[model samples]
Target: MYTLLSGLYKYMFQKDEYCILILGLDNAGKTTFLEQSKTRFHKNYKGMSLSKITTTVGLNIGTVDVGKARLMFWDLGGQEELQSLWDKYYAECHGVIYVIDSTDEERLSESKRAFEKMVTSEALDGVPILVLANKQDVETCLSIPDIKTAFSDCTSKIGRRDCLTQACSALTG
Candidate 1:
């Protein structure tokens, strides 16, 4: 199974349809960012399973083209209930986008815990983690450096540096 999956992955990577999973707490704007991506627009994507501020219920698969490659964007459910489901799919993912709400002060701790869980989880070892410092347009948003620090601290716990965390402004104009 691993061989077949690996071959398929190589084909996709060459053909450029590698899959990526996007994760963040509720209200992190993960969906909004996917909805507004240029590839989404070009694909004329008709979104499935849109949730404004609730647990994802399950995974939602979306497609976007990134120049040479087609990106399979997997938007994971961010609610606490859905966390258990994350480990099952983490191994299949090629990359990740870890989104965080910049303005939610009370939930930062929760976000940190969730991130820490991913950092320590066995399923995500050596995966490329892209941290999206979302909601940057808000008056009170976490800075890129702060996000990187949090990610770095979590990764340090594992005594490995496989988590490549990157911060991006998903909502900034």
Candidate 2:
């Protein structure tokens, strides 16, 4: 009875290993989004009241399962020092999810640079990228067309496919 209950509980919630890579520039809500998406709200965290999360480390893996698919969320290291390691797992991923803090105008250049690096890399050359123009709920979030244009142009710079990027709250299943 205990084993069955535990299994049911995990499945009912979110946990899995589909290997989804979340890439973006630093402080792009990459970590906080992962935290909130996986678990519920907590009162102890500093930004819990303001609705934000602290910085993330070099690398982290967050899991969320939908249906029978296990989503192994890979939160890559956003720092200049750690980004060199991104190639190690890029090939291992089935898909890519690029998160952009549309509200952060200052980081746009970094975002473009990072994205160019991704599409030009050997590992992610053909993998379909899902860009989350996140923080759209915010007043300054970039328009979907603008974000898509940025992404499309980056892919063009890297000579990769310019598939229409979609605005996703979360990629389910």
Candidate 3:
């Protein structure tokens, strides 16, 4: 009887875990987004002060419980060299959040290239992608339409998967 009751208790409390990857070019606000999410979703979680956040040299991990689901976020570093390591986590991720620094027009093409490569990987086939045009609060940031236009070519490579593009100021939201 005790064994059966313990099993029931475990089943009742276990959560469905989903692993999400937060990826983008350096300074694209991936970490900020993660911090904000944790603060919002997990009551009593005192996240780091956003102003003092620094470049993620490797990765940062955070978890939030929503309903019966637990979301695990892996915020990866976006440096050119670090990008090569992104694929190592692809197979395990349930979804990908690709952040683009809309205010940095000069690096837009480079960001697109990286994004194209990520979506084409067979490991990420059919994985849902959330494209965030970050830094929208900046005066000169690109609009969602502009970002969509710039990344139009990648649509074909994205395959038949759930994809969305939205403007977000990670720092402010």
Best lDDT goes to which candidate? 3
Candidate 1 lDDT over 4-106, as tens digits, reads 9999988767756688888878778787777666434575554443454345568777787766777888988899988877888887888888888877867
Question: Which candidate number would show the highest TM-score if scored against the true structure?
Answer: 3
Model 2 off-target regions past 4 Å?
A: 1-16, 40-52, 157-164, 168-173
Worst lDDT window (10 residues) for model 3? 164-173
Clashes of 1: 1
What residue pairs are clashing in model 3?
none
Residue range 128-147, candidate 2, lDDT tens digits: 77777777666667888887
In Å, residue 161's CA in model 2 sits off its true spot by 5.8
TM-score of each model, paired residue for residue: 0.76, 0.73, 0.97
Off by over 4 Å in 3: none
Clash count per candidate: 1, 4, 0
